[model samples]
Target chain A: MSRREAPLNRVVMALSLVATATWLALPLASVAPNRIVPGTAHTATDLLGWPLALLACLPLVALMALSRRLDRVRCHLALALVLLLLMALPGWLAIASQWLVDPELPQARLGIGAAWWLSLFWLSLMLIELRSRLALVGWRAALLPVVVATAWWLQGAWLGSLALGQELDGRRGDFLEAVVDHLLLVGGAVGASLVLGALIALAMRQSPRVERLGFAVLNFLQTIPSLALFGLLLAPLAWLAARFDWLSAIGVSGIGWAPAFLALLGYSLLPMVRNTHVALSEVDPGVLEAARGMGMGRGQVFRQVRLPLALPVVIEGVRITTVQAIGLTAVAALIGAGGLGSFIFQGLGQAAMDLVLLGALPILAMALVADALLGALARRLDHRRLASPGGAP
Target chain B: MSGRQVNAWAAPLLWLSLLLLLALGGDWLEPLLRWSEPDARRVLYPQADLLTLLVRHVQVVAIASGLAVVIGVGAAILVTRPGGRDFLPLVAQFASMGQTFPPVAVLALAVPVLGFGTWPIIVALLLYGLLPIVRNTLAGLEGVDPAVQEAARGMGMGGAQRLWQVELPLAAPVILAGIRTSVTVNIATAALGATVGASNLGAPIIAGIVNNNTAYILQGALMIGLLALVVDSVFARLLPARQ
Candidate 1:
């Protein structure tokens, strides 16, 4: 197609142009003399000088220009440019740290500014757009984030003066513990809900009344806010703990993991049961009939046929519940349920922005990772079913 | 309206009145709440009255949800149009991706950039709330059968007319469902704002947590839960039928 006939990839172009504008206009980084003091913001032009700053805009401009007509070659080039921009982001932060933080003052910190963050965000979006446009899937699609993450990881030592880095440095042990707690809580909730949800879904399948009442209760439980649920559970659980010495000994208190787990499990069940029910019910009856025609027993058909077909959808439910649980688990921190959320609440209490970032970023990463991994697993199972002979088309 | 229609409205109205009654006359429940905290001088939240907190909570959620609907639906509409179609995939992807970022984390992140207070809470809620609205709007608009669009075109309806009259009306149910989810989520999230210094219904809960007072926590939880139920019931009634 001629350039005029070929539609411009407006998404990438718009993203790049906005990124370019923001990168110049907003502060690139802020520098504080010490941890307690507020930072002074410095724009790209202020740090790199006008010429160098304008020069730095080269990749974004190229992305915008290349998107004018996105043929395979130009699209590849644009994708490369996007990846290069992402990888360079950490390098830029390292450079900013070197320039802004005083070597003499170990207490000084370099904070990431609005422009750097906006550029990172917009560029990631551009990468997503390019990846979709290019039809990259599976591992090919996963390559970009992995590479960028590796680049950031390798440059961590150089970012010692970065505020987020400094905060993490101080709380390395706490950070790891928080991550572990966050994962355990999320896992415990999702796992318990999955097993319980399957039971409920199975019972619902057996009886219409159970189906109606089960759904009603789960839905009502879902409508209550997480915090309120946690708060509501506090009194009762505390009363129970007081009443039973064993319960307190076992850590079933009004606060902490007990209520948090209960609340998370409660919130998680609706999605899990709904998905499991739908997945089981929606399995093609013809396949089951065919299984029976082959002299397969009910247990055999369920294990070898129905369960495999339902697996993907059930996994999908798990994905949703897991992601939701990850988020809610953060709120559980308020009840002394130690997790990354404690860092968030603690950071907020102390007015420590970097400390908050220390908590928030990992939670964000955990959610995204859980979503991608579960999504890929579901798709793989689905693809396998479609590929297998006599599987649902 | 028919009796059934009145019945449909009754749940929300009852919840709303109960919510208002509780907020306005919480002092009446002081005797009841005192049972939870036998020794404390104050059983009711002492700093701000429940009514004021309830209003502020509603105000925050209203503003956030309102802005989310406008911007989100507008963006969804824009990307679905022929002129803006190139952005549809990216917009859709972004919306779903945005949902993965937890609300509390988003709230925490907002504090650094927007600083403390109601605006950060509002911004966090708005941004977080936008995801569902955008996603559902896109699904709703796109799910409007092409045949229907062609039919509208056959009847000589213009683009804008078809959108406002046919497409939007047809998509209203799904879009309304999205708004309902968005508003419900925001009500819960807005309560988290109390930690960051924006006093709403969450203030009492936070106060309760700090002072280790179950009465304060219960009062706050009650009001928030009631507010959520009232708003949710109204949305439930507004929705055409449960999916």
Candidate 2:
């Protein structure tokens, strides 16, 4: 190693410092005798004893120390330390449950406290900072979460007394159903918008007037709040269902998935149409000229050249629409559309925070996963386009 | 400011007046709303008047978006400066990633930590709204021509002065666009706050859902939709001239 001292990495240093502070200062876990009663908060010192609690701070201190002279090896070591801290978090909760809960009391539950959450949050931020510093991307950046998740899975049995687990235990079937409902709603809306958006984009391409008017209408629809759009659709659909037996038989009513689907479709169209139009139009004119000079007709040029080049941006629009629809579908639960959001509103109605977590955590995970997957897909498509022999560099 | 500017304001003013008229004089629309729900005993949301609910709704969004602008823009500025440059990558990544988290999920998650109330809604909105502002501000600030910045330095402008006089002014249009997106999204999200006991415009929609009253839902939907339109129109007007 060089004798010269490296500059301090203040970002990681600050993050570790906050993590250490919160770990020691705030409650790490809470113990409740039953689900109905509020829990008694426990700080790290009380829960793990002074020696063990202080021992837990060792990695954080090491992280801060390492930041003063960050090198390639030190950065890698710091990332490993961060991941170790994250994985151990669930194990800590498992230990808390074992020590605090009475096995005889089946109703007993252990709640995660502020410190645990803050520590987890700060550690994740540190991981991000380190990952970018190390220039890790794609699957390399995903390793921490995979490891942490595996650790949590290994500790899952011990966390039977955990509040979130208990909530899921009681409503496992409903949870599965809600996940399905949420996916179906999001998938249906995104799929429909892709087709409709393409046709609209194609139509707009034929005339300047259509382009202006189409965008104007979609923009107006996009401006309306999801809740209001859902509300407005209810009365009209109900009236239509009342007048048409087929519509009623087919599950088209005032509420439920009909209004929800319609509203999601409305929200999804703006991004879809805009992206499609831009993607289809923004192809290089030189490329089109080359295709035409190669004796290709208009139809062949469009299908073989323009469409392939446009696929990545169109996929990007799908990504945005899918993520947006996932959230709006949750709001659709308010109008009797069954999804994970039912758990949220029901939990809020009952003042059951764990149940809210049960609902929220999964939705959060879904959004993140969808975003990651679709983003990867788009990047891969763009890469393929650039790499193709005939494609633009 | 100018005749063209005044002319540009016409659409927003029209929408604003229409929103206010509906909020203040919703009772006059009862005869029309009654047709939607002929069997219901009460056709309007009776718990609170529409105008008051409208005010409260706007207040919640205003407070949330205001704080988001300050903190979001401030953090963006900080990370772009020499002292804070080390933090820029993390801040930028977080801002983009954070937007992927659904607004409803954020609100739901907040309820667990912050408990139920208007404040949780505000906090959620603030947190959710911060992303666009930070993202846009970073883009705006970074988008400034380095040559222009170099010239400013050549003219002996200090770091702070160059930022204030050169960078921010050049970035104002983009920053304003971010604020517009944040405020518009927050207005919609705040309506969902009613389900969490916030009692804003969304309260009527929640109530209407509970009672199976179409009239009440329509009223709430109309007012919230109109509110969104009015605000969006104002942003639309503001955006064109500067761009």
Q: Name the candidate that leads on DockQ.
A: 1
Question: Model 2, which residues run further than 4 Å from truth?
Answer: A1-6, B1-6, B46-48
Question: For residues B1-243, could you state the per-residue lDDT of candidate 2 as single tens digits?
Answer: 699888989888988988877776656778888898999998967634787899999999999999999999999999999999999988887887778888889888887677778888898788889898998899999999999999999999999999999999999999999999899878877888987888799888877778878788877877777888889888988788764
Q: Provide the TM-score for each candidate, comma-separated.
A: 0.96, 0.95
What is the per-candidate TM-score for chain B?
0.94, 0.93
All candidates: interface RMSD = 1.4, 1.5
Among incorrect, acceptable, medium and high, the docking class of model 1 is: medium
* DockQ-derived CAPRI band for the predicted complex in model 2: medium
- lDDT of candidate 2 over A114-171, digit per residue (tens): 9998998899899889988898877887776888889889978888899999999998
The DockQ score of candidate 1 comes to 0.71
Report the C-alpha lDDT of model 1 over A1-393, residue by residue, as the tens digit: 555555688898899989999999999999998776889999999999999999999988888889898878899999999999999898888888888888999899999999999999999899989898889989988878899999889888888899888898888898899899999999999999999999999999999999999999998788676777887788789989999999999989988999999999999999999999999999888888988898888888888888899999999999999988988998899999999999988888888888888888888889999999999899999999988945522
lDDT (Cα, 0-100) at A298 in candidate 2:
87
